[model samples]
Target chain A: MSEDITLSLDDAQALSLDVLQHNGFSRAHAEAITRSVMAAQRDECHSHGLYRLIGCVHTALNGGIDTQTEPEIVDKAPSVVIADARQGCSLLAFEKGSALLVEKAKRTGIAALGITHCFHFSALWPEVEALSSQGVVAIAMTPTHAFVAPAGGQRPLLGTNPIAFSWPRPDGTPYTFDFATSEVARGEIELHRRAGKTIPDHWAMDANGEPTTDPTAALAGAMRTFGGYKGSALSTMIELLAGPLIGEVLGHETQAAGPESTAKPFHGELIIALSPHVFLGQDCDHHLQHAETLFEQILGQGARLPSQRRYEARQRSLCDGVTIPQALYEEIRRLGSR
Target chain B: MSEDITLSLDDAQALSLDVLQHNGFSRAHAEAITRSVMAAQRDECHSHGLYRLIGCVHTALNGGIDTQTEPEIVDKAPSVVIADARQGCSLLAFEKGSALLVEKAKRTGIAALGITHCFHFSALWPEVEALSSQGVVAIAMTPTHAFVAPAGGQRPLLGTNPIAFSWPRPDGTPYTFDFATSEVARGEIELHRRAGKTIPDHWAMDANGEPTTDPTAALAGAMRTFGGYKGSALSTMIELLAGPLIGEVLGHETQAAGPESTAKPFHGELIIALSPHVFLGQDCDHHLQHAETLFEQILGQGARLPSQRRYEARQRSLCDGVTIPQALYEEIRRLGSR
Candidate 1:
């Protein structure tokens, strides 16, 4: 029963910060990292939450990411902010660039942020969610590590690139959802492998490049993009928009050029913000009403909204606590002790 | 062999215009309509091409679409073009508004176009492609008739709701694609039904709300969104963006509200145009190069680019012309002669 005990969000954040600082990050850097971790845990995104702490430590130790450097931002245009992430963690860069992004978007009706040399290590929803909370319609995209094959191809040449979009509502929780272009996230495959379960046929391909239900083989080979050509095309769009458009490494070249980018685990990120103040004006509430009408119809049919599951989980975790594997908590404690 | 006879692009355009004129469309409106039809036929988009000519005539005659008016355009902001289609065709609205869109996007680095009270009958790619050819990055989203079921629900609540994005290339063909948020296009399902064939189980659902391979049953019920919940969310995003964001009818309400507005066949359309001149500056060539590099890598893997098939078809259609059934040609001729 003790092993099954859960931790409150505040306690988890404190413990995460403590462990991160023990692993050699400064207070500011540790705070930024822990904030994202706690948010993910609150959302019950276990893969990106406390479980990623060990990976973060390993990345820092192996120079896979820098934690302390500041982002250098340049005003490319009245509506464009170009931030050189300085081979550091993405959270800090996004945090530092938020003020400029918000101000520019409000002024111009739309703004774009290109963050280069970012090592994105957390869920992307938070980035756009922050903007949506400010009543901005926001979209965020970034090239991921390559693990997905293109349609009609055997080789993995594209990232399971993810796109996140959010629209502000009057009540303000936002109609927000983040999804990987792949049929299933790589995390799901890992879970299946651990659970000794066979995945559905569309989830991935075996090492021999044939569709396989075995998660281990799927991992050894590549993941399939959802909806065949449509998802692959969307992933391709993300790679170009987040990579080359922002002057960062292409997804296919990420591995081949690893030595060229040892200190950064990610290529770049693109953030777009649109202001209802300038564009929709008084129509924001009107738009929100129509959205609610559709939502009612969806809910009436017993279909959950896009992020409903995560949202429900977040509410539950906030009321109760976040459950974690006892061994993982012990490991974090040991790291903090050191 | 006469059934396989082809006509030049000019002849096809003329023939299409003749048919439309015979059906009561003014010269200006017919020209605009034919331009899109010719482009679709040239690109070998058979589903959206000449096949829909009869339906277009019927729609106009039944007062579902108006052919005797011009769209009223208002420049809401320097970068926002709002066009009231006045219960007319989407192409005329787009054509009338294109100049303002180009000027504003060039001046502001980005622009948004909202066209309301119009019926969109052709593929969306051509809308964005028009802007891409003007050397601007473009995106377009619009709702359709509600035929798609939400992810977990059985009843149809959303449209196919297509979104199109285009990145202008230096060589001028551009990287453009348009795809519906559904698993398969309704046109394809109709084709399968006519051919007495079964569709894939994932493509649609039966009236019993079960996944069905029977195309007729699928048509009787609802089509599924492409990638389960993800596609459903994308569809929802499109519904809001193209509907209320642009001041038009929502998909779920389009049918219910039809009697309220017997004149407008469509809800609305949203067009977003961004200038690489302002955003990329002289680096436009560099960005184009990188895109081409990705295209090369994609081609090397034997994966066709999203619009490559259409492009190839267009080239061939330009050279050899489009092939239509002899019976269909006579039908068109009969309509044109009347």
Candidate 2:
């Protein structure tokens, strides 16, 4: 087993940036991608952090990602934005369209961004948080490769599609959370199997549609949706909204949609910004304050709001730094040095 | 035991219209409400059908609803509309604003309606179905009297809030579904309890935060969010979006938010319309065709879409007519006679 080694934020970010730049990314692309990796690391989302650096590098080298292309954004209407990522980074598209989106929402109360030809490979919270900071209530969703089965079916037809939502808070960080429509992550089931622990009943199902407590049996089957049919509907909605609405590669933006082929990631993303400034007018402040009241009530009842732990993790990481597997660090170091 | 009596669609609609009118509703209000109740009955959603008419009449008589007032609609911006239901019927507000909402979405690609001082009851699907029929994608949500607790809390903080979403289809009926974020409906628990069967462990929590299988104990406690923290977040987002964004009754419009009063429903609702005709442009037909492809894939997986059963139920009801309790028919007959 590899031991975890601590790295300061600056060193970790610089190392990832160096590795991307060495892989042929321009300075701008390297920097933008590095920032996202660091944010996820700071929040201790190591799966989306430095651990995925090599995969991004591999994709960049294999033409799955355009190393130097910039996103093209067109303001089609007062409240509509059409963004082409040029088969490049989703962050680049978000970077170009976010400002225009914020401006449009502020002017017209709400705006939508249809992002196509993108490759999104990180947590969606950062983009939503960015919009919230601009006093914009935001929602973001993307369709990925399928890992979840729709409810009542044995076949995996829907992606473990995740959605991120944020509401602006004038006093502090935005209340934000991202969650999959699935009952449990694929990694969670694997962990239980490795540990010889019985899985929960609703977590997964065997091939015959019967719930199983054995983690290994569950793995051989399919993951169940979190609330059965309702969660399945939400997942299907995300696929529909993110895929066809943005004009991506059909409704399921994955290689597994038809006969499988070795293909680069082709995903679509959607971002909606609703501005309280233009929409709520004089009542915006009042609404924000009332939101705080609701938060207090939830806290009083011993319920923590979503994203509280993430924010706390980020704060602690700022003081103590990020930790990653020693072998992974060595691999990144060798790539950066090359 | 009450016998089930079958009522033709025309007779059922006329009976409802007569009762509402005799109770003080104007012709327009009576017509709008009768149309909705009949649709729900036709769809075999008996819980939201004639079952809830008595409560509607009770509220109207107690001054909780304004029988004489018409909905007030103000088009505030190119993509924004503010609607005041004026303590009147929700169907009337929907009737007035849906056309305007459709028009605005077609013009701006996306439009939003913030409806205040409304008394929304029954299903939200009809309004969304109306928008979809106009070739617009729609989402609508409203917070009501609190029934479900936040993820970790013992006290209820959110309504069994429902969200409805629909996508337009050129081929047939638009896909639509509305669902509460709660893990299990109260009626589901009651049935299991009456049957002396143990409830699902994740369905509800006892007053002390322990998961319980006893339905009666769970009823004494609080219902769980569908997917734990994620479902809680969706519920909270709905409350924030529907409550304060509409500026209804000084924010957080439900009665449980403050000292209990005999006030009317006082709910705030949010309706958003997105037009594919404007946003998708040349790819509109292509997107719809691709959507059909995705649907075929899911259906081929032996997974039924969310509303398939509801549509099938409607078709059956149209052929066989609606079945209701004999007592309910007598009550409506007496009210109509008065």
Separate clash counts for every candidate: 0, 0
Clashing pairs in 2: none
Give Cα distance to truth, residue A168, candidate 1, Å: 1.9
Please list the residue runs of candidate 2 whose C-alpha ends up more than 4 Å from where it truly belongs after superposition.
A189-201, A205-221, A250-253, A256-261, B187-201, B206-220, B249-253, B256-261
Please report, as a residue range, the 10-residue window in candidate 2 chain B with the lowest summed lDDT.
Answer: B250-259
Candidate 1 per-residue C-alpha lDDT over A123-185 given as tens digits, one digit per residue, 9 for 90 to 100: 888788889899788888888877898998877778888998888877637788899999988
Candidate 1 lDDT = 0.82
Q: For candidate 2, lDDT tens digit of each residue in B199-220?
A: 9888888777688999988887
DockQ scores of the candidates: 0.57, 0.68
